[model samples]
Structures are given as structure tokens and as C-alpha cells.
Target chain A: MKTKLFAVPYIIWMALFVCIPIVLIVVYAFTNDAGAFTFENFKGMTSYASVFGRSFLLAAIATIICILIGYPLSIVMSKFPSNWQKIFTMLIMLPMWMNFLLRTYAWMSILEKTGLISQLLGLVGLPPLDIINTNTAVVIGMVYNFLPFMVLPIYSVVTKIDRSLIEAAQDLGATPGKVFKKVTLPLSLPGVLSGITMVFVPAVSTFVISQLLGGGKHMLLGDLIEMQFLGTAYNPHLGSAIALVMMIIVIICLRIMNRFGDGEGQAVIL
Target chain B: MKNMKKIIALLLAVCCVGAVMAGCGSGSSAGTNGEVTVCNWGEYIDEDVLDQFEEETGIKVNYTYFNSNETLYSTLNTGGASYDVIIPSDYMISRLIDEGMLEQLDFANIPNYALIDDQYKGLEYDPDELYSVPYMGGTVGIIYNTTMIEDEITGWSALFDPRYEGDILMFDNPRDALGIALLYLGYSLNTESEAELNEAYALLEQQKPLVQAYVMDQIFDKLESGEAAIGPYYAGDYLTMIENNPDLAFVVPEEGTNQFVDAMCIPKGSENKANAEAFINFMCETDVCLANMDMIGYTSANAEACEIYAQELDEEAAAIMFPSEEVINRCEVFKNLSPEALAMYDALWTKLKSGA
Candidate 1:
């Protein structure tokens, strides 16, 4: 009876949000270049492999950058005092509460020529840096926006660890670095895995930040999917095909993370 | 599990019933008599035109705005949108008509089609004048700050000049970006040859480092603030931006740019066709079109509005509303390309945008 109740909510939720859209996307993906139902849209994807390849490569680079930056920040956030941590946590989340478009717009204001940053740089006699629309700017925006999601999960697992274990390592003649390496790290592996999953997955689909801050320069997987919906792809079905592939890639990433991701340095190294 | 299964079945039944009701509501999209929802770009319309249309027709008018064409396309295409009339650019309008997304315009309702110029008629996409009515027309050009630069920045090459590295902005659009590259190569904006595309892509990659920002609406703000010295934008939008900032100046680049016309169309599935048509006819009125021109600062297609342009705006300012044939000839209107060509352009654009 409980299993049936669980199934009820799950089915309703999926029906309302996920399954319906997926069905629409699948039908559309098989549509012709003119957007009528046909098989040509799928065939179009192969002839344009570089688009998919470039999208995949950009997503991978963004994912790797997120992991590299997120891991340390999450680990540090996990070690903060409870009351202070809660305040710090909200401070981290404050930026996200602002509209995503607004945040990216804010970056443009800061990065543009004669922008506040550039003016300030000129005042100090350093030459202006044109960061807007660059891949580097896109990566910076990703790290800024997604760092909090990475921090929370690691913090959750770190808070649950028994501090006595770290003390035990210290009492047994372990250094502070050794205690973290052997004791706290192994225990916090679950949180790290969760954090990595949270950061990497969402970062792959980040379109607005890249569009706004990347100066229309970077075409990530998210932007490609958007092109289909906007009729720029010349075929709705092709857009659907691209989106379906992107979804599959995301699922694969999740599965891989579940299989081998760990916070423990030993498990991570192995 | 048996008890829960019954509850689950009941929930599914309830949801299905709700969906069926919603389906029926959507099916009655052609309105007999109800409100007509009009969605357009923010600050792009004359509010009085909307008011006068509502006043004359007695069809309740609900208006909303989008900041970009992509946003407009996505919102209208969402199908749940209640918009009876939408304004999209030439390319987007062509794309919609190609997809059978636009409703056939009944000429009996909009007899004022004669108000449209002969030159505007018989364009490639709406050749038979079946679906769309031209609203406002303009071309993309360079808007700049005269105070910032000493050189007369006459061509696309001026944009790439590194001396203005932090001062240069570009339109944050693949079409505009790609078109500029193609034009610089003395090719058509619709070129799709692999070699030409690769050449354009390479140029875009090189130019990326020089752009301070890829801006759309904010390009106006950036220009006003002196955040950027020059960027590509529609001539009508540039007119308004210059109005607000007297220091700003705009010109058609010596090489060329794309001319565009935004048109009004009714969607096939709108529930309020009567109200939609009434609103379209109302907008066609000389007074209404003039009011729309006043609010939007764009050149209205209504000949009457063009005649009244001087009365509404001083001669110097009104002159910007109309461009000479020499200026028109310097630019080309974007044509609907074949699917293969579109895909090739998209592919090159993708690599240019992503690879860098």
C-alpha cells in the first residue's frame, strides 16, 4: 500500500512535468526541417557533428572547472561553526536569489569596455581587460553562480561526521594534515560526491550565464538546445535530437558519478 | 499496495478530467468575441495605438512586451500563450509562415493594405501577401559615440580596430555577427558555402577578443553610458537611443548591413480572431500608425504616418525615420535560405561561438 502511494506522487509529478515535455520533445525531434513529423531531423544531427562535438567539449570544460573550484570551497564551508555557517551559507546563496539574467547582466556591466571595472583599472594605470564573452568569462560566471550548490552537500556530510574520529587520529600521532587526509576526508566522501554531482550537472546546462557574460561568444550545449526552440536550427526536430542527446549525456554523467565519485582522497585517486 | 492502487487510479482519473477540460478551452482558440492579447517588444510600440484600437473596436486589448525576438518566438511558440497578435522580425516571420504557424490573413478585413509601399510588397517570404502585414521597417547599422573616437569609423574594419578594444561592442546575435563577417568578405548575408562559412567563422573568432560586450537591448544603455563606442543595431532602435543621448550618432556602414521589417500576424490557434483582426485594422489607421510611430520612434509603414513625420518630429529628427534608396541599396534584406544553407551557417556560427 505504501509502495503504491509512493508510485502515485512519482507518476503524477513525472506526468505533469518531465514525461509530457520529453514526449513532446521526442515527437518534435523526429519532425522534418519544416517542423512536420519526419525522420530527417535525426539524420541532420550526424551531418553536423562538430556542433554536437563543440557543445560536448564546452560542457566538459565547464564541468571540470566547476569541480576543481567547488571541491575546496565546499570542504572549507563544511568546517565552519554552525551558527556562522548558516549565515555564511545564506550569504553564498544571496547571489542566486537575484535573477539569473540580472546576475549575468551585472557581469556584463562589470566586464564591458568603459564599465566600472575598466574605468577603475584605467584610474590605476593598468590597461583594460576585455573579459566579456570570452570562454574564461563564461567559466568565471559558472563558478560564481554554482559554487553554493557545491558547498551545501559537502557541508551536510561533513557536519554528520563524528569529530571524535579526527581526535582519535591526532591522539594516535597523526598530523593535522594527516587527520584530514585519512579521517575527515574518508568520512566526507559522500557529501563530496553529492556536491560534484550537483555542481557538474547544472553547470553543463547553464545557458543564460554563458549567453549574457560570454558576449555571445561561447556556444555550449545549452545554447544549441535553445537555438532549436528559437527556430535558428532550421529544424525543430534537430533541436529535439540535440536536446535528447544532451539529456542522455547528463544521465550518463550522473551514473558515472554514482559509480565512482568519492570525497575520500584514496577512493578518488584509485 | 492494493488500497494505494485504488487511490492512484482515482488521482489519475481526476488529472485526466482536468486535462480534458483544458484541451477543450485551447480548442476554442478562434474567439467569437473576447479579449485580444497582443505581445510585442518592450518600449517598441506606440501605447496610444493599442489604446485607440481598444477604444474603436470595443475588443478588450491586453498587451505585453518581450525584450528580444528569441524571447518573443519562444513565448508565442509555447502555444499556451494567449497572444492573438504578435510582432516578429522578417526572418522570424518567414520561419513561422514556413512552419504553418501563422494564420492566413483575410484581406477583406485589412483593406488598408494599400497604405503599404509597392517596394514593401511582394517580398520573397510573404510573396502573395497572405500571412503578415508590415508594421515598421528599418536596417541594421553602426551607432557610435562621436566624443570618444577621432577617426571616422566608416566600415566593419573600424569595429575590429584594437585601439578601441575595450570600447567596441557587438550585437549578441549569431545572425548579425555572421552577417557582418560575410559582408566583410564581400559575400551575401545568406551565404552558406563551407569555405565562406569557415572564413567567416575564423574572422568571428579573431574579433571575439576585441568585443567589449555582445549586447542586444543593453547596447543602447552601453552606448548611452559611453561603455562602448560602437556596435551594430537596428536603425530605428538607434534613432531612439540617439534621441535620449544627444551625443550619440548613427550611420549605415560604408560596406552595408541587413534591412528588416517587423510584421504583425495572427496565430492560427488564437481564440480571439475577431478581436485580433479588429486590432490589426485599428493599427492600420493613419492616426493609430502615427501614434505607434510616435511611441516607438520607428518609421511606420503607413504612408499617412510618413507624411505626418515632420509634424510629430522636427525635420532633423524626422529625417532619420526615412532613408534614401542609396542607403537602402547599400544594405540587403535578409532572405530565407534553404535548410541546408541554414544548417551550414548554424554549424559555422556554432564553432565560431564555441571554439573560442
Candidate 2:
């Protein structure tokens, strides 16, 4: 009874911040500016199908790049001595402590025509890197900012795997590679799934990255929704509808990934 | 022991609820004469002016900022905050008036209203001269790195010139970007016609390949560092930029451009109307306006204050910063669009951005 009583504050907080906002979004999504019931918001969203496609495509590419870089780094970090692992983990998290906007702005300077990279390349008699206002810069920003989310989860899970189980596989005349693949890989599935969710969700929904690095040349789902509310468009009904659709799509994507990861990933999703 | 733990848990929950209620209570109860909330553009005013206003009036100021007029509109439309005084552009003032969101100024309280230039008063946005007191005014023009582009830039066509391909920056917002395109095509900036707007859209689409990026405040960094060759931005900001990079030059294109005026107004339901009026009156004083002009590098709307500011500039600088009557004649102010027009702009802007 006391434990249940202790949860009252948390329940109130969740109701006020989380549950209420979601209900309001759903209500606004189905209504027009005059508060009349309407499906026009959704009907008009077909025009923005290209933005939806671009956002998901870029986010998926960023997520894949993060996994490619992070999975091996996490494995290597897990193999380090315990104290060394702690230092490496700290290094991975150090960049995140700074403001996210400041880090993105730093990349803007680094990727510009006369920026640090270009100057160094010039010193070597190479052409300047001209990728500042392109889709490539946005992808680089997503990978740089969200890479730690991918690394830390996999590292923690890989570190916590039972050492005795791996030794047991080794004793059964199994080669080192086979024992590691069959034992280590299966145990880390939950971590990898969670990491993908962490990286992909924020990457798809990020407006700042696309605006600052992508040069506002392309509209992503985040930019489209922002335009309706705060940009010149000023239509909250459409903004709410777009947000609802994006949320539904993201939820569907996570559901499929969870099923593919099997029952172990269910615990992480919750 | 369990009874003691229950008592502790009950106290913790009570404290949490009590704290939230306390926070909510404090914000809405500040309707007294000692406090006035003011919302203006980010980095728009000199901080010293705010401090001086507070010192002179003995009315504590709760200052806030919004980046764009649309953000300010949404903030008020949603009742997000209760601001006593708001400074917004001319078109937005007209929209707010149409929505009955603004209060008419008591000019008797603001005696300094007489100091505003006659040209700045009774304009289209506030035809009756009842609501707003003009604060700052400027024209949109091209700023270029003279070293990078040796060709003389005399008009908006320079933005589309392939000679400066991969070196041009354009406005990020739909209104300004489309407005420039309309001006380039010899259409009125405030045209409500669909065909005219579509023509503007096509011009912008054609120019997209030449543009290095679409930017707003970032134009400062890009132009000052010589990373971009040419772009269109406010003339006042060009003045600020040329100080950083001597290679920079500004021109009010031969084809006319936007002449924007930001004014101060009190929103309806203001808690301290008299205090807000006093603050606006204080801002109109010559010394105060001159101080702000110096800090922000924008042209002052106060006639005497503008003269004093122009005296400090040399002949060429003065001519560029304060264009002669001939150039001013060609410029047009933006008017508030109807709901249909605004929606069309939003749709067209989305299409342009998505590369559709």
C-alpha cells in the first residue's frame, strides 16, 4: 500500500505532461481551426508525401551508419580492461555534455568551403571539401550527434553477458569464431534493437539538423510540421495531423523491429 | 515501520503537488503596477535601454523575446504568455488588429508620438494612426563580397546570375524569398493574384540551383567570413557586416524592394496599460532612439534621431544607409494576406522546399 502511494506523484506528472498532450494532439488532429470536425488536414497531407519519404530515408541511412561504426567500437570497448572501459565510455559521452546546437554549429564551420577541413586539404594540395549545404552534411550531423546512443547500449549489454557461458561454448570443441557468433551475438540483440530505436527516432524527428546542415533546401517531416505551427504557415490543425501520422508511422516501424528481434526485445521496448 | 513509511510517502506526494501549484500561482498573479511584461524581437533592443526604462519608471520589466512575427502571433494566439507591450512588423500589426488582439494606444500618455516622422505615420498597416508607434525601419537589398564578384550588382537579377553560381544565399522564410522573386519579375510585393504568385514560385525554383543555401541570421556569418559571394538581406544588417569585412558592398537594387517597419503596440488584456504606454513614450525620446540605432545598426524612425545618426556617417555611407527620396519611392510595404492567400503561400513554399 505504501509503495502504491509513493507512485501518486509520478502518475500525476505523466498524466499532465505525457497523456494529456497526446490526447490534445489527437483532438486537434481531427478538427479544423473553427473546432469543427474535419478530415481535410489528412487529405491535404498527401502533397507532403515527398517530405515524409526524405525524412525516413535520411534517418534510416544515419541509423545504419551509426550501427556500422558503433557496433564494432562497442565490441572493442567491451574487450578492454574494466577501468579502460570506464574511460572509453566517458570519452563517448563527453561530446554529448555540450549543447546539441553548439555542436551542430561547430560542424557548420568545419564543413564550410574555407573551414578547417578545407584548409587542411588545401595544405595538402587537394580540393576543398564543398559539402556544407547538402544532404550529406545533414547525415554527418545525425551520425555524429546520435552515435553515442548506439554505442552505450550495446556496450553495456555486451559487458554484462555471462563469462561462464562463453567458456562453456569454448570447452565443447567449438572454434573461437563460432562460439562468439552463436553466444555473444544472440545476447546483444536486445541492446542493438534499442540502440536502433534511440538513433532512428530522434534523427527522423529532428528539425534543427535539417535546417542548419541541410540548408533548408529540402523539407523533412519535422520541418513541414514546424512550418505549420511556428513558420509562416501558422496552421496548428495541419501540424497536429502531420504529427499524428508521423507518430503512427514511427510506432509501426518500432513494432516490426521488435517482432523481428523476438521476445527479448519486448522488454526493451516497454 | 510501515506506518512511518506511509506517512513519509504521503508527505512527499503532497509536497510535489504543492510545488507545482505554487509555480502556477506565481506567474499569473503579476498584475500589479510594479511589474510590466514586454516582448520584443531577439537582440532587437539595447539591454541598457531596458535597464534605463526600469530605472526611470520604477516599474520592473519582465522582458522576453520572439524570433519572428509568426512566433509572436502564435504565442499570443495560444495565450502562451501575457505581455504588456509587443513589438512586431507592420503586416503583423494589421493582422493582430484584424483579430482584435491589440489595444489602441492612449497617445495622451505618449506625448512623444509627435516626434515620429510624418512619412512613418498613417501608413497602410495602421491607416487611422491609432495603434502603433513606429520603432525602426529598413529596406531589403543585396550585400556582396566585392572581391568575389567583380561584376556590378544593380538589381535582384544578380541573385539568379549563373556567374555567381554556388555562391549565393537566399532568405529562408517564404514571404521574403517569394517577395524578392515577385519584385524581380516586376510584380507587386503584396499581389494577391494566384498567377502572379505562381510566376514568383517558378522564378525561385529556377534560382534554386544557383543558391548555395537558404539562410536568415546565418547570413551574418556567411557574408562576414566571405564564404558566400552575394545574398539579399536587410540594409541595416549589411551596415553591421561591412564593419567586419571591408570587402563587402551593399546596394538597394534598381528594381524596388521591401520597406519594413517594426512598431511597438500594447496587446489587449494588458495588466499595466499605463506603464506600457510610458515605456513606449520613453523609447521615442531622441537620445533613447539614437542609442538603440547605434547599437542595432538599424535606421531610427524618430526624425531628429535619424538626422543625428546620419551626421556621423560619411557621404557614401549615409547615402547607402539612408537612401534618397527617389529610391524610397519605389519601395512597397507588405500587407496582411487573406487566409486563402496565406495558405497558398504555405503550399507553394512546401513544394519549393521539397524540390517537387
Best by lDDT: 2
Q: What is every candidate's C-alpha DockQ against the true complex, given to 2 decimals?
A: 0.40, 0.62
What tens digits encode model 2's per-residue C-alpha lDDT throughout B1-356? 99999999999999999999999788546433477889998878888987788777777788899999999999999999999999999999999999899999999999999999998999999999899999999999999999999988999999999989999999998899999999999999998899999999999999999988899998999899888999999988888898899899999999999999999999998988999999999999999999998888888889999899899988867887688999999899999999889988888899999984
Clashes per prediction? 8, 0
Across residues B86-156, which tens digit of lDDT does each residue of candidate 1 receive? 98878777878887889988878888887876767777668888988888888787788999987787887
Q: Model 2: per-residue lDDT, tens digit, A1-270?
A: 999999999999999998999999999999998899999889977788899999999999999999999999998999999999999999999999999999998898899898889999999999999899899999999999999999999899999999999999999877989987889888888889889988999999898888888888988888888899987668999999999999888888888878777677542432
Q: After superposition, how far is residue B305 of candidate 1 from its true place, in Å?
A: 2.5
lDDT for A193 in candidate 2 is 89
Interface RMSD of each: 3.3, 1.3
lDDT of each: 0.75, 0.91
Model 2 clashing residue pairs (backbone) = none
Off by over 4 Å in 2: A267-270, B1-33
TM-score for chain A of every candidate model?
0.83, 0.96
